[model samples]
Target: MVFVFGVNFPEQRLASLERFYGVGPQLSERLMARFHIHPTAKIGALGGRQITDLNAELTKLTIENDLRRKIQDNIKRLRDMGSYRGRRHAMGLPVRGQKTRTQITTARRLNRVDRKG
Candidate 1:
């Protein structure tokens, strides 16, 4: 059961042939029609508007622009820090603390590789 705007809706739908206590049968039908609530005999009006609003709120959260700005700002700050060591550490790459003598490998593209080989 869901309550919306101080209105209580039953878990089961109201019978199409039956009349609701406060709302008459015809009035109930009209309310259901206006709100696009399912007319199934077992489930009362589930309040579609409330569900729609909830979905909209979820969409708003997913598309928030402030979160994007914060992420960009953090990346920019990491990039601006002086010194190669600090920059590498901020970017999650191998820093000077790690030994790279024989472990580090560089890429050889077609333009850089020796054609004589």
Candidate 2:
């Protein structure tokens, strides 16, 4: 199955970018620390970078402005791995984790959370 999400928001895009690289929690935390963005920063809490240039996208709205290019590039890089990592990417599993059997999942759970609660 394909994971389809709207990345119209910069905060959402930043989050999606972290996952796009398949970077783990440690790396994500480190990157956030280095970049000076709060670990719990919401979109409104961010400035400058959180603004997506709709005008830019409207003008140069090719892959350069599209998330599809980034996703394709990562997938290509993984495919070039030719083994282990590539296989994990293909299977949608964490390429660096040991708890593969239990942790390898997509957004299925998020879509079907316990609404009764």
Candidate 3:
């Protein structure tokens, strides 16, 4: 196993870095390129120095809980300001003008004043 940013990632392909919150395909590819790790490289195949470098790089990013908290803060700010989007989020409705006539379950589940990470 390899520990990256306080999370344990078992010996898996480098592409699995996308499993980290806020690290999408593009971000993961960039991270791999920076480390010179092959796309198919497994966690166990990484050298000691490479692992340390990865840990340092990940620490500089606002991923996982940090990113979630940042988003929640932004929503809270809007709510405090009484913005229209904040009202929608507070009411558990679509915030981006999506039709609420059908398929609004996603909005109700996600757009909330106190959203869970």
The model with the greatest lDDT is: 3
> In model 1, how many backbone clashes occur?
6
lDDT by residue (1-110, candidate 1, tens digit) is: 75432335565635332332234577556654655656663444444664555334334442234444555455455566765644654544454566545543321211
Model 2 over residues 1-117: C-alpha lDDT tens digits? 112123344444333224432445775576556556666665444555433332232234233324445555566576677766555665555666557456445422221212110
Clashing pairs in 1: 12-42, 12-43, 12-44, 13-42, 13-43, 13-44
Summed over model 2, clashes come to 0
After superposition on all C-alphas, the RMSD of every candidate to the true structure, in Å, is 19.6, 11.5, 1.3
Model 1 misplaced regions, further than 4 Å: 4-10, 13-22, 41-117
| Candidate lDDT values, in order | 0.44, 0.45, 0.87
Give lDDT for model 2: 0.45
Candidate 3 on 1-117: residue-level lDDT in tens?
788778788876453578878999899989989999888888888998988998899889999888999989999999999999999999999999888899999888999987776
Estimate candidate 3's RMSD in Å: 1.3
Q: What's the C-alpha lDDT at position 21 in model 3? A: 86
Q: For each candidate, what TM-score against the reference? A: 0.27, 0.34, 0.93
Q: Which whole-number lDDT from 0 to 100 does residue 70 have in model 3?
A: 92
